[model samples]
Target: MDEQPGLSEQYRRVSAWPLFIALGLPIAEIGVLFGLVPIAIGGLLLFVGSIAGIVQESGYVERPWNLLAGLGGALVVLGAALALSQLPGFSPGAVLAALGSNGLVVRGVSIVVAGVIALGVGGAARFVEQEPI
Candidate 1:
């Protein structure tokens, strides 16, 4: 195969990030629609990780920790709002029931959880930065 002219190292034509990114959202949605916890969690993890990876690979950031943390923070806020919006009232029993039976609550909670995970991962990644010699 002849190499393409002017295709330098900075030009990325192939990457695994897009594949996982494509798969993650639908998988998460499927889980949410069906009220499946594990699938939703897994899908969210894949989705967030892949997003950070793709962003870094595309040269948007030398380190994606800040990006992931920002995303996580946004998710947490949005999820809380969504969950609260779906609530009927503030009764503890009602909340518990909603968590168990309500799809919207489940979706909101899942998003919040995913966001926390992303935030933690991002915070942890920040400390693991490679120091140039």
Candidate 2:
């Protein structure tokens, strides 16, 4: 009988965050280019969440909530810009029209939605505490 030696020690540990992040970016790009709102939003969320996970795993930050919140804020602003820039005017009618038929507006809204989720998750994580009794 023979047994494997040093198998445990030689085993390599890998993180999935980097891979998901890589995949997410391209998916997001494709979605944006093709005007696919759901794809764009899903990709953005996956990418942003992966980043936070990677940062936390790397020990660079004690908590990823802050980073998530920051990324979310940036996304919110960027999305707002994209959504607003398409508008010809600030009138409610114009807004409705753009929202109904504009791809850019749709993408922007998707981004904003992802951002808000990230922000809320991040902010809410801050308040979570685990106590061992």
Candidate 3:
């Protein structure tokens, strides 16, 4: 007869998924940036992968509040990015218009900033007390 895994073993297995997702997102994004994959396909993969990871990690498939918080975080990041693009000396439209532009650098910096923000949100989410239905 096969023995069942202990609680700690099960917890360890479950906890590893988020780390895989955190590492995978940057790799997927880099592949898109490097033209290794089509942008639409890469974006679709990332979107689906991210949502699945969020649902699995947060256990929020049946709990809408966590999903709402995640969506709100994404919107905040998007709004900040748009505002930054309009600031003096950082217009993305102008950056792309110039020949041999620093668009890659801008993109890299934004990715790093977004990653940091995501980590912050994830860390904070852990501290929130969830009430059972």
Candidate 4:
């Protein structure tokens, strides 16, 4: 007979991904900004890690705590992005001025995209059926 891992063990294993993403990404971004590594490499790491964390957490749709952890990770990533965008000569207002009215369109689209992602995270936690252990 095959022995399955206990619930606590399973949870511990599954929870680590979100926790790492939520905590690690910002540190990595700061390191990048401090010139510890090439900006391209650090940016790529941040982007991939964020996507992986979100996708991994989506698998835990039945677990509210896991979803909440994912949301926290996403927020951390968003904060990092905002910070990066403000660096040196990349201010949003300056870019928006260059783009004229099209900047408003871009901002509106981004808001809609963020809303959809938020809905997915919250809706999955509330609506998805948990599998029996």
Candidate 5:
């Protein structure tokens, strides 16, 4: 690439926004879960992150932001799992009786699956970014 100038650099900057935001994910989570900030901000971050991941060149494929997103998302799901284990609706033995009785098992399983998938995707993205262009 020979530096196309103007639009190219602009796009590059735009592309980097997600990487920047990924680094700031903790703040975004805090704003949404703890600070009680506007959902709009959180929603915007999620939307931009998704779009940036898809459209931008992301340098290669090993994008750190993508990896972080996947890992961080998985961690979020894991935390939920730990918290759910304590809830009266479910336990190691049974989910208020049986895993299927309350039907929470399905949802829990889905969340864990989603988390794993996210982690895989994020790791792949990071790999792409780190690879030789």
Candidate 6:
């Protein structure tokens, strides 16, 4: 039997990125709704963060949930159109118009808060030795 101290820290750091996305997803979605220029980039980040969170050992924390939420948001903003485009050969600019914007301050704030909390939890988790408690 063996335990690795670095494992928890690694997971915590990896997970933090997802929380950042979750925080940003709302803003990105809003941008999509507003027809802004940065929406696509924001949406891209959401997708990347979600995919990463889904695959990585982020542990059960805000980041993992955030990733899932971000993915859901991406779908809400443009999933159906993409599917329709494949079927009838139709396209809408909504797919490319959902991303970061000046109004994303709210999302940025949430992401920072979630990140701080997750870091604390992950840090605390690391300090707790893997043993019966």
The best candidate by TM-score is: 2
RMSD of 3: 8.8
- Output the worst ten-in-a-row residue range by lDDT, candidate 5: 35-44
Candidate 1 at 19: error in angstroms? Answer: 0.9
RMSD of each: 3.7, 4.7, 8.8, 10.2, 9.1, 14.6
Residues 11-129 of candidate 6: C-alpha lDDT, one tens digit per residue: 63434556766766676566545545255445545544555465555444533444444444544345343334334333335322322332333233333333343444444554564
Q: Which parts of model 5 have CA positions greater than 4 angstroms off?
A: 1-98, 128-130
lDDT of each: 0.81, 0.83, 0.49, 0.46, 0.49, 0.45
Per residue, candidate 1 scores C-alpha lDDT tens digits across 20-57 of 99999899878767768778767877887889889998
Using lDDT as the measure, the top candidate is: 2
TM per prediction = 0.78, 0.81, 0.33, 0.28, 0.36, 0.32
By TM-score, is 2 or 3 better? 2
- Model 5: residue 49 alpha-carbon error in angstroms: 8.4
Ranking by TM-score: 2, 1, 5, 3, 6, 4
Higher-TM-score candidate among 3 and 4? 3
Question: Residue 110 deviation, candidate 6, in Å?
Answer: 24
For residue 128, model 3's alpha carbon misses the true position, in angstroms, by: 29
Backbone clashes counted, model 1: 0
**What tens digits encode model 4's per-residue C-alpha lDDT throughout 57-132?**
6674434435444554464456445544544455567645533444333333232334345445555655575665
Rank candidates, lDDT, best first.
Answer: 2, 1, 5, 3, 4, 6
Q: What ranges in model 3 sit over 4 Å off?
A: 1-23, 26-48, 51-58, 61-100, 104-133
- How does candidate 1 score on lDDT? 0.81
Error of 1 at 120 (Å): 0.9
